[model samples]
Every structure is written in C-alpha cells, then in structure tokens.
Target chain A: MKRFSLNQATTRHWPLPDLVAGCAEAGVTGAGLWREDVQAYGVERAAALIRDAGMTVTSLCRGGFFQQSGWEEENRRAIDEAATLGAPALVLVSGGLPAGSRDIDAARAHVGEAIGRLVPYALDAGVQLAVEPLHPMFASDRCVVASLRQALDLAAPYPAETVGVVVDTYHLWWDDGVWDQIARAGRERRIACFQVADWVTPLPAGVLLGRGLPGTGCVELRRFREAVDAAGYTGPIEVEVFAEEVWARPGADVLREALAGYRSHVAELPAPVEEDDRAP
Target chain B: MKRFSLNQATTRHWPLPDLVAGCAEAGVTGAGLWREDVQAYGVERAAALIRDAGMTVTSLCRGGFFQQSGWEEENRRAIDEAATLGAPALVLVSGGLPAGSRDIDAARAHVGEAIGRLVPYALDAGVQLAVEPLHPMFASDRCVVASLRQALDLAAPYPAETVGVVVDTYHLWWDDGVWDQIARAGRERRIACFQVADWVTPLPAGVLLGRGLPGTGCVELRRFREAVDAAGYTGPIEVEVFAEEVWARPGADVLREALAGYRSHVAELPAPVEEDDRAP
Candidate 1:
C-alpha cells in the first residue's frame, strides 16, 4: 500500500485539483501525472497543489516523439516542465517512423542518437529520460522502440541516472524476453519507472486506449511485480490504465478500484523465507 | 510472374471458380487456398479447377488452432485436405490462450506439443507443417505463435521436411531479429512459404482485416523477399492481404491491383548477375 501510486491516466477525466485532493484523501502518497494535465492547470500551481496535499509526483507522462519536426525544441520544453514540476523522471515515447518511410532500422538508430542528444539537458534538469518501448503494433506509426532490449540499448550510452527505461506491463507483457531484460536493466541501474496495466483483447481501433486495470485482464501482474522487485527496483508501482471505459467512471470510484486491484494482484510480493525456515 | 501466387483470402469475396479463372488469366501459376473456402467449394472440385487451369496450390492458408477442443481431428482433416489439393505446405496459425487463461508460456508449449503430434500425419501426407507466427498484437485471441523464432524453435524438434515456418512480412517486419531468423530458417531448410503484405495503420477494429497491398503501406516488402531468398527459399511469394476495403472491390479488379502491387514491390527480386556479365 505504501508503494501504490495512482497514475492520472487511470482517471483521466478527473480534474487535476480534484485528483490531487482525492489521492490525498484516499491515503495515496504518490501520483503519476501527465504533461498536458499539469500544463493545463499550470505546472507551478499543480506542483504546489500536490506538494500542499502532501503527495509526490512519481513521474511526468511523456517527453519523446523524436521523429517529428521541431522535436528538439519540444523535448527541451518538456524537460523544463518536468524540472518545474520537480518530477524526477520524464517518460519518452519515441515516436514512430517519419511519414512514408519504410526504413525502420534507420528510424531506430535516430531514436538512440536523439536520446543521446537529450541526455545533457535531462541531466541538467535533474530529470531522468525514461525511454518507453511501446507494443510492437505501434512500430510503424507510434514508437520505433518496440522492445525493452531496444530501449535499454538506446539508453546505454548515457549515464544511468540521466537516461533510463520505463517498465510498463501493458506494452511489454507479451514479450518472452522481458524478464531477462528487466534483470539487465536492474543490473545496469536503468529502470527509472515501473507502471502496471493489464493486457485486454479485442483491442479498440488504433489500439491505444485498450489497456485494462490490473486484475481485469490477462497479464500476470504479480509475476511482473515480482520480477521488477527481483531486479532490485523499489519504486512506486503506478496504476496506469488507458481504457475509455475506465475513464468514464467517477475518479474516486476508479481510485478505489485501482487500489483494490493493486492490493489483490500486485501488493502480494512473496515473503522472504528466513534461513531458519529452510530444511537442514 | 512465375513466382507470383495470389492467396485466396486476398480476393475473399471472389467465387472459387472466378478466382481460379482470374489467376489463370493473369498468368499466375500458383494459388494459396484457405481450408474453409476449399471445403465450401468441395476440396476435390477446387483441386480439379486449379489443376485443370494449370495452376499449382502454393500452400494451404491454415491447419493449426491447437488451443481449441478437437484440434487433433480438425488439424488432421486440414492436412488431408492439403494433401488432396497437392499443397506441399500447410500453414499453421496456432490459436491464442485458452479462454480466461493467463498462461501464455503454457499456451506456447501446448502449440509445440500439438505440432509434434501432427508431424507424423503431415510427413505421411507429404505436406510440411508451416508454423505461421502472427503479429504479437494477435497474441491473445488470434494466435500465440507471435514470432518467427518461437515458430522455428517449435519446428526444430521435427524433420525439416515435415515441419517448417512461414515468413510473412506483415507479421514480421517490425522485428529487428527477423533477418537473422530468416537466415537461420534457410540454414535449417525449414522455409516452407513466404508471404508478402504491407502494414497500414489506424488499424480497423478486430485488426484481422487491416493489411495493405504491397506498395500501399510501410513494410519493406522487397527487403523481406530478399531476406527469404538469401535464406534459400525458392518458393512462391504469396500476395496474401486481408482488408475490408479490398474485399468489397470487384474480384478481377482486386486481382489486377494485387498483381501490380506484387510486381512493383515484391517481384523485383534482384536478378542473378550472370558469371559471364561479372567484371573480369
């Protein structure tokens, strides 16, 4: 429960002020926020509101889309906003290929180079650039970084504190190689943020908003949590579903369900057996 | 043109006879058949129609859905139909997770065992069981074999002549490791069939029918054809695409467009630089 955090996206329709107050009232000490919401409410005001409510900003939703024109200026602004909000990590959804381009290998190389270019700004802002590997379905038009190995590799050239990877279960649960990659990220000290969401089927058109609340779909959430923990991560587990159905519910109601789902599915880390309990 | 094969699904609305006549008129010597269409038209009749037109069955559209009940009998019948149609390869789209189950690893293991069980039947029928790895987006409900590597691993335990893998560009283009895997498949002599389709986005709901014609989307179709050829696959390149818009068009019109797309994007495989033409 102490580690539970409500990502703003889980209750997207909730006002930032209401969301902050709701999290405080519900005993949630952490909240992952999105840049649009914070900027809409004024970054300074949103920061002060969360700070006043005795809650911490776990992360800032995004800062990458390297394929677009003017990405440099746009990402620099994002880094500034993260610093202003005192968010330690800025999630980077490396955008997909340039329009009409079929050169994915070149696109991936550009993402790595783009992140390298941003490392200095990210370090200066005291914010970690968290490279998120979107699901492979989005490889053509969303994010070219479609696997943890690719994300980790993209971040490898930078200082671990300046560039890291986001471990979001929704985007990664289908991969058989993720467990090993999570371990490697841990060994390299590159896991900046951990998010929880379930993989639901009959994915909606565009497939972006089809994520389910933990325990509501097919992902082995506990196994993922256990794997992240085994990989030496003790960060906040942000519940970050993006389903339209979830957002239509009352924010408070969604928060309660999110907490309940977290308790039932993610909070039950296996207890370490004492040496005395082992067979002789 | 000799290597061009129009998979029946590309012009799904076309009647079996019309599709055969259309392929014959277009100078295509190969046609990939779907089991449902073949069964509906009467397998023997469909075979005779294709054979009488001097066209060969490049491969059968499918034969695997191991997660469902009675899969053994169903797959056996599929193999027998492929044999009757003279399809040397029977492509397998292994079904997804059993209902309400989260054990993807188990589902994948079940696919391997199921293939092993069918190997004897496939060998006896002189048909290679080609495991078709669907894109990972279909990992939950459509197919559990979501990458060429997994399909190859499953095929590794059987004779290459009896077990092989399908190299479909639409399902595999996003994979950074696919080129190497195609080489490995060739080295193992397990390349049974090669399929070409472009990946278009703003994917429609259900996602099964969103594939684009070869030049209509972002996949490097020529690169994939080259990779498979370098991997030693000298087989028909089936232009297999599933799209609602495509199916709604006139069958002959679609076939002509498919042929044009194939010629522009896939059939331009590099010609052999003759020994006599090489610089002395």
Candidate 2:
C-alpha cells in the first residue's frame, strides 16, 4: 500500500504530539516534523512521543542556513538535533544570497563548503542530508539551490548514502529538465524524499506558506509520480501543504482534506511501465 | 557613452509619438516599442516617426503564444507585424500551460514545433525571434520558458542569426545559473537584446506590474553587465521597467529616472572580462 506522511507545517496549529497522534488516527504511516516543532517540544521528547505513537518520521523539516559568516557551529548542532529526532533524513534549504554578498556563486560555494563539513557529522548520526531546491524567486533572499540538476551536482562528490535530493512539486514544476532529473536521481540512487505542494501564488519572499493542495493547481501530479516511481523510488509520499489559509482551518479537517486530495490526485499515478529498466 | 532604450511600456502614460520624441529630446538612442502602441498608431506611421526621430527600434515587444491547438496562423501573423516594424528582434514569450493539459513536456514540444515552423519566416523577414524566459512564478499562467539554459537549449538547434534569447533582468532576477547562462548566450552570439527591471513586491497577477527602476532594488545590475560584457555582448542595454507605480507617475519623470539610474549603475560594472570565464 502507498504510504502518506503529513509534514507538521501543514498543521503548525497542532502540537507535535497531537499531530503525530492525529496522523496515526488518519491512518497515515509517516510524518515529516519541523525543526522548530521538535525544538519547541525538545527533540528527545518529540522523538519519544512519535515513536510511542508508532509513526514513521519521514524527514526532519530542515537545517541549512550557512550563508552567514559564523554558521559552522550552528550547522553542526543542527546535525546533532536531526540525529536525536531519529529522522531518516535532514532536509537542507541552502541559505539565500548572503546578506551584502552580490556574488551568488560565492554564497552557493559557502553552502557547498558548509555541506562538505556537515556531511561527515550527518553520516555519523545516521541522518541523510536531503538538499531541497527552492523556487527561483527565493534565490536572492532564501535559497540558492534552484534546480534538481544543481542539487544533484552539489551532492555528486558526497556519498549517495549520506546525501540525497528532495523532490518537491511546487519548487520544480517549471523546470524543463525535471522529468529527466528525477529519472537520473533514481538511477543514481539519490532521491531521499518526495514532497507535494501546488504552486499558485507568487510571494515576494517566495515561501508564501500558502501552497495549494495537490490537484488544486496545474502540476501534473500523476505524471510526476510516474517519473519517480519509474526511478525505483518507493518512499513516503509526504504532503507538506504550506497554505496559510489552509492551516487556519482545523488540523483534523485539513488532514482529512489532504488525505482525500492525495488519494484522488496523487494516488492515481500509473506506476512506471518497466521496473529495473535503469540497468546500465 | 552607453545608450538607453525606452520600452514603450515604461512611458505607457504618454502616447507613442510623444514617447519617441521624448526619447530623442532626452538623448536616449534606442526604444522597444510594443505591439499595441504600434497597432494603435499604425505600423507605417510609427515606423516613419521612429526613423524621422533618428531613434533605433531595439526590439518589438513580442511574437509567440504557441501553446494552443491552432495557434500557427496567429503566431505567423505576429511574426509579420514584427517584420513590418523594422525591429531587429521579436521577443517571444512562450505562452502559459495550455488549459487541461498537465503535460508540460508535451506543451514544451508544441512550443518547439511552433518555433520550428516560424523560424524560417523570421529569418527571411530579417528578424530574430528572441525567446524570453519569464520568472518561474509565471510558469503556469505566463511563459513556460523560465530559464536561460532551457531557453538556450530550445534555441540551440536553430540558427543564432534566426533565433536568440532576450536577457530581461526583471523576469530572470532570481535565477541561479544567470551569469553562466548569460555568458553562454553571449559566447554563442545569441544575446540579442538586454533589458533591466527590479523585482520588488510579491507578484500578484495585477501587482506583477510593480517592477522597480534600474537601481531601485537589490539586483546586481553591474555584475550582470559585467557578465554580459565578459561574454562579448555590446548590444544596447534597454531600460524596460514595467512598474505600474512608475507608470502612474509622469512619463517624462520615469524616463529621466531610468536614464539617470542606468548611467550610474552601468558605470560601476567592471570593464569587459574574458567572455568565456566561468568564474566571476
């Protein structure tokens, strides 16, 4: 059976314990927890609660804002937190163009160097660093990784077992090469996670947190799923709807709606025609 | 000694002839005239006015909406209008995702096939089709051509003299591979037109018109110019600010501000570096 995971941000209104319990009630086998939620409740406590609730922690929300000058220590500590939470993956949104740095290449390099240093720690902690490419609108003030190819390239030298890429529809719906990239990532064994969110409104900050639920927009979710499934990825299909309006509603209602949307929209994707066809 | 090209949309408050005369009076040597402006004044009258004023038509606003089922005739006619205006290039914004068609790949193929049919006509008419990649925010509702690399790849198999890409900063400000792509376009001799506008507020369909003047926001205009020059591009830098707010101001004032900002910002860029240097 296909598995569903609710990213905690979808229900930021609910406490982590409640969210986990809610996911269990909704029959979702997994959950993607946010760093702030874990931090607020304490990582160890949140981990205990989630485990007791018997839910899969698909991925930890994030840990990568290394564009600033003195961020190495901060990043290392984040690695520790990810390990403590027992997350299978630690999603990293490389910080935006650094403050006062016109050289985006430099900012990107700073992120690369930071990732290089943090990888060993992540490997030690049994946490995979999943690089998440944000929408291009966030290039200036949020993240510099803006495409799957770039993300895959950044993770190239790193061990695939320790570093992978997260495929989120909202951020990647526009890329011409996204389909091919998904197939390549699958063949390379680097798809760490798959996420769903619709791109409807364009925010200045880019992360409007008002992402539409799947099928509410034009993203070919079914085609996208087929591409990932073809790539031999059988991971939790995490629904991380960042809609501010949607979150304003009751968490239980939102979960119910998300589940319905996921089934009607994402679940119908035809599995790829061939399996193990990625043979060299 | 850099030249300023007033995009008619910049002085949308003023009529076309008045804007042309204004450009002449202000020592702005070039202008990007829009289709509506040309159509209202009649192409013959508009062309004569531009020629008599001794001003160059940098480019005609656009000529491509190749997503629909039967758009070839309409597209061909737009190409004809571009040719009649004596504009050196016709900026082609590949239209939005077709309704009910979730297949972006198919949509892209349709765009390519449409362009393929139109290329010979463009070449014969002495006009290059300039493909402009809009910001990803408009990926669904506007242009599907959202990356310079994607645009370049689309234009690659075509003749550089027949087809090229428009480097518009406002639409592409947030792109990660910008400098590299700009440099590549320059090397390929496909950098047909240069445009500038700053991304300020969030993009609502209506507020997307709120682009900033050249020096207004955080865009590294100087760095961009350096990158373009380094790639051996010596084309006129057209100030194409699409600010609804600026248009609400007096037309003359917007032109004056754009002129002053362009001179100040363009002056700070480094002298042309190696056109092929990958590193800044």
Candidate 3:
C-alpha cells in the first residue's frame, strides 16, 4: 500500500477534485496525473489540491511526440508543467514514423536526437524525461521505440537524472528480453518510472485503450514487480490502465480494484536475505 | 513474377479448385496451402489438382501447436500432407502459453523439446519444419516465438535441412536485429521460407486479420525481400496477407493487386555483381 499509486489514466474521467479527495480518503499517498487533466483543472489548482490532500505527484503522463511540428516548444511546456506540479518524471511516448515514411531507423535516430535536445530543458526543470517504449504493434503509427533496449539506448548519451526510461508492463510484457533490460536500466540508474498494467487479448480497434487492470490478463505482474525490485528499483508502482470498460465504471470502484489487484499481485516483495546467508 | 506465390489465406474465400485454376490462369507457378483447406478438399485430390495444373506447392501453412493435447499427431499429419503436396517446407506457428499458464520460459523450452521430438518424423517425411516467429502482439495468445533471433536459436540444434525458420516481412519488419539474424540464417542455411505482407494500422479487433498487401502499409517490403535474398533464400516469395477487407474482395481482384504490389515493392532484386566488375 505504501508504494501503490493510482495513475489518473486508470480513472480517466474522474474529476480532478474528486480524484484528489478520493485518493486522500482511500489513504493513497501518490497519484500519477495527465497533462490534459491538469491543464483542464488549471495546473496550479490541481497541484494545490494534491498538496492540500497531502499526496505526492508520482509522474506526469506525457511529454514526447517528437515527430510532430513544434515539438520543442510543446515539450518545454510539458517540462514546465511537470515542475510546477512537483512531478519527478515526464513520460515520453515517442511518436511513430512521420507521415508516408517507412524509414524506421531514421525515425529512431530522430527520437534519440530529440531527447538529447530536450535534456537541458528537462534538467533545468528537475523533471526526468522518461522514454517509454510502446508495444511493437504501435511501431508504425504511435511510437517508434518498441523495446526497452531502444529506450535505454536513446537515454544513454544524457545524464541519468535528466533522461531515463519508463518500465510499463502493458507495453513490455510480451518481450522476453525486457527482464534483462530492466536490470540494465536499474544498473544505470535510468528506471525513472515503473507503471503496471496487464496485457489483454482481442485488443480493441486501433489497439489503444485495450490495457487490462493488473490481474485481469495474462501478464506475470508479480514476476515483473519482483524483477524490477531485484534490479534495485524501489520507486512507487503506478497502476496505469487504459480501457473503455474500466473508465465506464465509477472511479472509486476502479481505484479499489486496482488497489486489490496490486495487493494480490504486487504487494508481496521478496524478503531481504540475512547477512549470514551471504557469508562465505 | 516467376517467383511470386499466393498463399491461400490472402484469398481465403476462393475455393481450392478455383484458386488452383486462378493461379494457373494468372501464370502463378507456386502456391502455399493451409492444412484445413487441403484436408477439406482431400489432400490427394488437391495435390493432383496442382500437379495437373503444372503448379508447385511452395510450403504448408502450419504444423506446430505444441501446447495442444494432440500436437504430436496433428503435426505428424501436417508433415505427411506437406510431403504429399510436394512442399519442401512445413511452416510452424508455435502455440502460445497453455490455458492460464504464466511461465513463458517454460513454454518456450517445451517448444524446443517438442520440435526435437518431431524431428525424426519431419526428416523421414522429407519436409523441413520451418519455425515462424509471429509479431510480439501475438505473443500471449497466438505464438510464443516472437522474434527471428529466437526462431533461429530454436532451430540451431537441429540439422538445417530438417529444421529452419520462416522470414515473414509482416512479422519481422519492426525488429532492428532482423537484418543480422537474416544473414545468420543464411550462413547457417536455415532459411526454409520467405513470406511478404504489409502492416496496416487501426488493427481490427483480434488483430489476426489486419495484414495488408505488400505496398498497402508501412513495412519496408523491398528491404525485407532483399535481406532474405542476401541470406541465400532463393525460393518462392509468397504474398501471405490476412485482412478482412482483402478477403471480402473478389479473389481475382485481390490477386492482381497483390501481383502489382509485389512488382512495385519487391520484384527489383539487387543486380548480381559481374565477374568482370569484381576482377579489379
């Protein structure tokens, strides 16, 4: 419970004030928010609401879309927004290939350069730019970074504090190589955010908003949690599910289920080894 | 045009007889087949039909489903059918996790052992078992083998003639490591089959039927064709798309479009280096 955070996306339609009050009442100490939701409620007001409720902002939903025009100004604004909201990380969903373009290698190189250009602004704002690798299904239209290795490589040239990677299970569980990449991210101190969601089948049209709540699908959620822990990540675990069915339900109901799933699947961290066990 | 083969799934609604006649009329000398369709039309009868039309069966659609209860018997039948139809290769779509199973590592290891078990049957039948690594999107429910590297690793222990891999553009296009893996496959002589399909977005529900014709989506079709060719795969280049929209159209119309797309995107193989030019 101490490490559990309900990402606002899990209850996307929940009013900002209600979400803050609900999180406080439910004893949740952290909340991951979206830029649109914050801007709609006024970023300062949203920040004040969370602060008054004595909850911390775990992360801001997004900052990247480097393929679009004016991405520089847009991302700078996002960094400012993250700083104003006291969020430590801004997630970046690197946009897909430019229109009518099939040059993926070039697009990936552009993402790396885009992040490099944003590093100074991110540093100044004290917000880590968390490069998220979306699922490969989105490689053509949503994101060019489809593996944790690519995200880490893109962040390698910048300081760990200024540029890092987001470990989101929904987009990464299908990858067999992710476990090693998670360990590498931790070794480099580049795992800035860890988000949890399950991989569900019969994905909806467009393949977005098809994520399952923690235990509703086939992902080895607890195994992923343990892997990240073993990799030295002790950060807040945000439950960031996006599904139409889940959103249609009451926010409180969804939050409660997310908490229950976390408790069942992610709460039992492995016990620490005794000093004697490590002795030769 | 001589290298083009139409996989039946691309024109799924066409009757087996009509498809055979259509291919013969269109000067398509090669065809890839599905087990169910062949069985429905009587494997012997279908083989006779193709043989009578002076057409060759390039490969069989599938054999592996190692997680199922009767996979050994099922795959044995598939091998026999492929041999009867004169297909040198039997493509295998390794099944996903058994119902409710979470141990993907164990599932993958089981696939290796299962293939080892079937190697004798495959070799005796004179059919190469071609392991296909499907897109990662199908990792959980369709196929656990999700990358060309993994497919090659699984095939490494077996004789190249008895065990090989399928290089499908739709499946391998997003992988950055595929070019090197293709070269490795060529060096190892494990490239049993080469397939082409484009990757259209806004993927329909279930995602199994969202593949596009060669030039209809963002895949670098020409690059994939050249990569496989460089890997020493000089076999039939089968266009194996699976889209509801394509299926809804007339088979002849779809075939013409497939041929046109192949010509525009995949037909221009790199010119062979001349002996005189190489003799500096």
Candidate 4:
C-alpha cells in the first residue's frame, strides 16, 4: 500500500501542534514542516510533538534564499534548524534574480556559489539540501532554479546525496524539458523528493500560492506517477498544495480532503506489470 | 541599423487601416499582421493599403489552429491569406491541447502532420510557414509549441525554406534552453522571424492581454538582440506586445512608444557576427 504525507504548509491556518494533531487523527503517515513553524514552536518542542503524536517528519520546509545580504549566515542557520528538527531534507527555494539585475546567468552563478558554501554544512548535519526550482513567473522575484535540468546542473558540483532537487509538478509541468530532465536527474541519482500539486486557473501576481490540490486540475497524475516511478524514484509522493482557498479551510478538513484526493488519484495508479510477474 | 516592425497585435484595439497609418507615422519600416484583421479589411485591400503606405509586411499574424476541429480548412485558408498579403512569413500559432484530450504528444503529432500537409501549399503560394511557440502558460488553450526547441523539432522534418519558426522574445525569454535553441535554429536555417516583447509582473487570468511593450519590463532586450544578431538574423526586430492597456491607448501613441523603445534597445545590440543564418 502507498503511504501519504501532507505538507503542513497546506494547513497554514493552523498552528504546528494543531496541524500535527489533526494529521494524527487523520492517520497520515507523515508531515513536511516549515521552519517558521518549527522556530515558533522551538525545534526541540516541534520534534517532540511529532514524535509524541507518532508522525514521521519527511522533510523540513526550506533553507535556501541564497541571494541576499547575509545569505551564508542564513543558510547555515537553516542547516542547523534542519539538523535540530531531525528532518532528512531541507528544501531550498533558491532566491530569485537580484533586484535590478537583468543577468539571469549572474543570478544563477550567485546561487551556485551560495550553495557551494552551504553544501558541506548541510551534508555534515545529515540534511539533504533539496533545491526547489520555482516557475518562471518567479524568475525575477523568486528562485532562479526554474528547471530540473538547471537544478541538476547546480547540484552536479556537489555530492549527489547531499545536494538534490524537489520535483514539484506545479512549477515544472509547463516545461517541455521536464521528462528528459527527470530522466537525467534519476540517472545521476539526484532526485531528493517528489512533490505533487495541480496547476489551476486564474494565475495572479504572487504565483507561489495558486497551486491546486491533487485531482483538482489538468495534470495527468497517473502519467506523472509512471514517469517518476520509471525513473527509479520510489520515495514518498508528498502532497504540497498552496491553494488560498484550501488553506482557508479548517486544517482537519484540508487533511481529510488531501488524503481522499491522494487515495483516489495517486494510490490507485496501475503498477507496471513485468512479464515475470504476469507468468507467476 | 536594424529596422523596426510593429506587430499589429501590439495595437489590437486599432483596426487595420488605422494601425498601418499609425505605424507609418511612427516611421516603422514594416508591420506584422493577423488573419482576422486581414479578413475584416478584405485581403486585397489590406495588401494594397500596406503597399500604398509603403510598409513591408514582415509576417502574417498566424495560420495554425492545427490541433482543433477545423484544422485542415483553416490552415488552407490561412495559406491563401498569407499569399494574398505577400507576408514574408506566415506565423503559425500551433493550437493548444484540444478539448477532452490529455494527449499533448498526439496534438504535437497532429501539428507535425498538419505542417507536413500545409508546407507544399505554403511553398507553392510563396508563403513561408513560421511556427510560433507561445509561452507555456498557454499550453492548455493557445499553443502546444511551447518552446523554440519544440518548434525547431516540429520544423525539422520539413524543409526550412517551406517551414521554419518565429522566435518571439515574449514566448522564448523564460526558457533557459532558448539561447542554445536559437543558435541551433540559426544553424539549421529555420528562424523565420524574430519578435520582441517583455515579460512582466501581475499575471491575471487574462494575462494574454498583459504583455509589456519593449523596454518596459525586465527582459534583457539588448542581450536578446545580440543573440538574434549572433545567430545571423539581421531582419527587423518586430515589436509584438499584447497589453490591453497599451492597446486601449491611442494607436498613434502605441506605435510611437514601440518604435522609441525598439530604437533605444536595438541601438545597443551588436550587429550580425555569424554566418549560418536560418532560412525563410
């Protein structure tokens, strides 16, 4: 049976403790948490609450914003938080193009430099830095890692295990190179996590929060599952929606809906049948 | 000096005659026109008016809806219109993913097949087909040719003189693969037209109408010009904004702004430094 995890950010209206308690009641296997919540609750207390409720922490919310004043210090702090929280992956939203800079290549190079400085600390802390390539709409004000190929290239300079990428369908579905990039990432052993969400209509300015829950939009979820599975990634398929409407709903209701949507759309995906299995 | 061409869609609010008059007043050397306007003006009259005003028709607005219900007949008619207008290139907005279909690959194949069938007709009519890959945001409703690479691939099986691509900065700017794809298209002799517009903020559901006029947004226009020039594309850099607000402005104002922006941006670009120029 496939297990499910709900990113706590989806229930952002609720506090960490309440969100975790709701997840526990809903019988979710795990939760991906944001560092802001962890800091608010204190990392030690947050981890304790998760353990007390018997929930696995699949991932820490994020660490990368490596294009600002004091990015080195910020990244170090993020890695420290990831370590303290006992999370396997520290998701990195690579900072967007620096203000007033029209040079995307320069911004990308800045990201590479920042990540290079942070990789060793993250690896030492047993935290994998998962670079999340944002959609191109965010190319100016958000992450410069806009494609898996670009993310993989940035990760190439680091050890694959320590530096990886977050495969979020929302940011990447429009890209033609996605499948090829996924294949290349898999071949190079660079996939850190597989995140799923649907791309919905009426995209507004603040493009980050417009994602739909699974089964609510046009993505071919089954096909996406098949491609990732084919690429040798059998990790937790985390549900990470940022819908304002969904977040506005009660955390418990959101969790219930996410689970139901996940089960209906993802868990039922047909497994690839091998010839040997058929014979058996 | 590089010449400036006004893509009439930049002043979509204006009728054909008024747009031509505006462009001529603004000292634009050429105009990129759409089929609907041509139909409205009556094809022969539109061509005659453009000739009378002494404006070059750089490329016809569009021809491809090859993924929809009326693909064949529509494409044939588009060829006729392109021929009637004596358009240097008949821009093809390869239609989007069809209604009730998740098969983008099938739609793409259909586009390839449609182009294959239409190429000979286009050649016979002396109208070059320029495949225009719209921004990926329109992948579901407007165009499946979402990247220059994909457009180049679609054009590969056809002769460049018969079928090629339109490299519009608005569509191709977000693509990290763009520079390389443009270079390759140049090598293959497949760049049919070069268009310009800027990517901007605050994308609404009607974002199709929110495009920025040249030099009004974050795109590195001079850099784009350098790349186009480096690819041996010395054709007029056609300004093709689709902003509703810009269109709502008087047609004369739109043309004046577009030309001024184009001149300032293009003046900084290095002239052609390469030999392998794309065809058609």
- lDDT score, candidate 3, position B129: 98
Q: Would you give the TM-score of chain B in model 1?
A: 0.96
Which residue pairs in model 3 clash with each other?
Answer: none
Candidate that would win on DockQ = 1
Ranking by lDDT: 3, 1, 4, 2
For every prediction, compared with the true complex, DockQ reads 0.78, 0.35, 0.75, 0.38
Model 4 lDDT per residue over B1-280, tens place: 3368888888888888888777766666688888888898899999999999988888897888887778788888888988888887889998877775667778888889989998888889988899999987777678878889889999999888899899888877767788998889889888899899987776645457768888777787887788877888878778898877887898888887887787776546446765656442
Q: What tens-digit string does per-residue lDDT give for candidate 1 at A1-280?
A: 8889999999999998899888988999999999998888999999899888888888998888999999999999999988988888999999998998999999999998889889888888899999999999999998999999999999988899999999999989888889999999999999999999998888889888999998998888999999999999999999999999999999999999999899988897558999999969
| Poorly placed runs, candidate 2 (over 4 Å) | A201-207, A268-280, B68-70, B173-180, B201-207, B230-232, B267-280
User: How well docked is model 1, in DockQ terms?
Assistant: 0.78
Q: Tens digit of lDDT per residue, candidate 3, span B164-184?
A: 999999998888989999999
Candidate 1: tens digits of C-alpha lDDT, residues B109-182: 99999999999989899999999999999998989888899999999999999999999999999999899999
> How many angstroms is residue A39 displaced in model 2 relative to the true structure, after the best TM-score fit?
2.8
What is the Cα-based lDDT of residue A259 in candidate 2?
Answer: 88
* Higher-scoring candidate on DockQ, 3 or 4: 3
Please state the i-RMS of candidate 1: 0.7
lDDT of 3 by residue, A8-122 (tens): 9999999988888888889998999999999999999989999989999999989888999999999999999999999999999999999999999999999999998999989
lDDT for each residue of candidate 4 in A172-214, tens digit (9 for 90 to 100): 8877678998888888887888888887766655566778888
TM-score of each: 0.96, 0.89, 0.96, 0.92
**Among all windows of ten consecutive residues in candidate 3 chain B, which has the lowest summed lDDT?**
B263-272
Instruction: Give the CAPRI class of candidate 4.
Output: acceptable
Pick by lDDT: 1 or 2, better one: 1
Q: How far off is residue B70 in model 2, in Å?
A: 6.2
Q: What is the lDDT, from 0 to 100, of the residue B236 in candidate 4?
A: 70
